[model samples]
Target: MGAVLQLLSMAGSVLGFVFLTLCIASGLYYISEIVEEHTEPTRRFLTRTIWVIEILLLLLLIFDKFPIKLTIFAMGSHMLYYQNLKKFPYISLTSITFLSSCIVVVMNHYLWFKHFNEVDIPPQFHYDPNYVPPRRATFSQVSSFFAICIWFMPFALFVSLSAGDYVLPTTVEQAKKTDEITELNSETTAKLRGRTIGLARVVIHNVRKYIYSVLALFGIQVQRDYDNLGI
Candidate 1:
């Protein structure tokens, strides 16, 4: 009975992990779509907020209120993220900015993990047996610090950053061109209804290809079809 229960528990754990991974992938994909759709506004908001945080971290460091090393690291990470702004909406996975962004993510995760661990486990001072340790951080204080100082900007940048390979036309002229092409090939009158139906079929096929490309990001296997929709 105990073995059977253990097997069930292990199965449940595996299923839970799969579900969580799917949720994260879907959420990231949705965020990337939104960022691609609103590139300019998203860029401005992220850039401004990052700079603000960098300034605040500098001030805290100046006052000797924050760990100087961690503060400087955080500020540097923000600067790296700022560099990507120059190539906004066209991030190369192999570019310096993207690589730096990846590094900073790991750095932030390590720094905060260490910080929280330190807070939770006070070091023993062998020299002073009776020396009292400082008070541990409250849950709210820890959460606030993690949200604002440790994870906020990094996570936001990760979600906002899109691969250059997936770049899509977002300009007014490009959109107009797409519309014109679609209209030129699609017939509005019943006399040309057969052509319209064919165009609709092609559009549906292209949409399926787009969805398959998105799924490929999650390591899903898909057969590619290069048939272009008239547009």
Candidate 2:
């Protein structure tokens, strides 16, 4: 009885983990949907945010005497990040601008990490009151810096940007075009040429569909997949 109880506890823990993970993913999906819907406003917000960050970095570089080289590098990365705005919310995953931005974010993180570590106070001076600490950032400073400058932009872009399928979303006008193409040649699959929903919607719809189909195959029906729509 004890062994059976232990097994059940472990199984319960596993289910709880899965439930939390699904909750997080669903929240992210919902946020992405909202961002895509308000593309113009999202774009404007990101653009203005870059300007504000740039000004803050400039102040650090000028007054705070942040490492000049690192400051310039951070500014350059922000510039690269700005390039993604040209295409707005929809960025091609493999495109040069997007790939370069990813690389720059990683590089900035490594450079800043190494810089801070180098400036960290040595252990030998721990008891020496006269031994002044190096101009290393404090806990609060580091936290605020990373939160505002280093990590903020990349995270913002991650949530705001979408690498959608190459096919555009079908609309009323595009539906007419698709029908014409289909009529011209039944061999042509114009139906697949466009997606009717956003990328997140597509993934959620397909995954739920596959799960339901699998359950049916196993003669298990927890719920019916009546609606094909997902945000």
Candidate 3:
């Protein structure tokens, strides 16, 4: 009986996680739609936010005794992210700028994860256990810095940027290819769009479809119509 209860509890946790993931995915999809509607304004805001974060990083580097190499690299990563803004919300996945941005996102996460786990990553001054820095980062300070300066823009981009694959039809052949719109690799659409689509939208669409399929098999009905990934 205890073993059975344990198994049931695990199953419940798994189910809860899956449900929560789907909900978040749906929210991201909705946010992406709103971002599509406000592309220009959103682009400007992201640009300014990048500038602000870069300034904050400089402040930390000079004042907080943050590791110099890591701070510089972080700033450089932000620059790469900024490059994606030229085309604004539409991104070419094959582009070097987009690929570099993705790399830095992972690198930043990995660096911060290690930084937070270890002490004395700073200069020699940090080894003096008795002497605390004048402007040491407290829990809230670091948390906010991590959330806003480090992670915020990347997360925002994930929810805002669309792949360039779904292009506005230009040619007569493309115009007749309504069926190609749904495909990721339709030659006409891919040629015109250059392979851009909302990365997050695609994920949300597929996730919702999978969840709906699973629920349907169990006689559960999902009311949310995510047929076009919230369009």
The number of the candidate with the highest lDDT is 3
Q: Model 2, range 107-216, lDDT digits (tens) per residue?
A: 98888888877855678987888998657678898778888898988877877776563344553456576566445453344334443234455556577788888999
Cα lDDT tens digits for candidate 3, 114-185? 876675545876667787644545789778978997899899988878865353536435657654445545
List ranges where model 3 is wrong by over 4 Å: 1-16, 120-139, 165-197, 211-224
lDDT of 2: 0.76
Per-residue error for 8 in candidate 2, Å, reads 13
lDDT of 3: 0.78
Please name the candidate that would achieve the greatest TM-score relative to the true structure: 3
- Each model's lDDT comes to 0.66, 0.76, 0.78
| Predicted candidate 1 versus true structure: per-residue lDDT over 118-195, tens digit per residue | 833345565677877666667897787678766877677667764432212343355466664345432432122221
Per-candidate count of clashing residue pairs (backbone under 3 Å): 0, 0, 7
Error of 2 at 134 (Å): 2.0
**TM, every model:** 0.62, 0.65, 0.71
Sort by TM-score, top down from the best: 3, 2, 1
Q: Is candidate 1 or candidate 3 better by TM-score?
A: 3
Model 2 worst lDDT window (10 residues): 188-197
TM-score, cand. 3 vs. native? 0.71
Off by over 4 Å in 2: 1-23, 120-131, 165-231
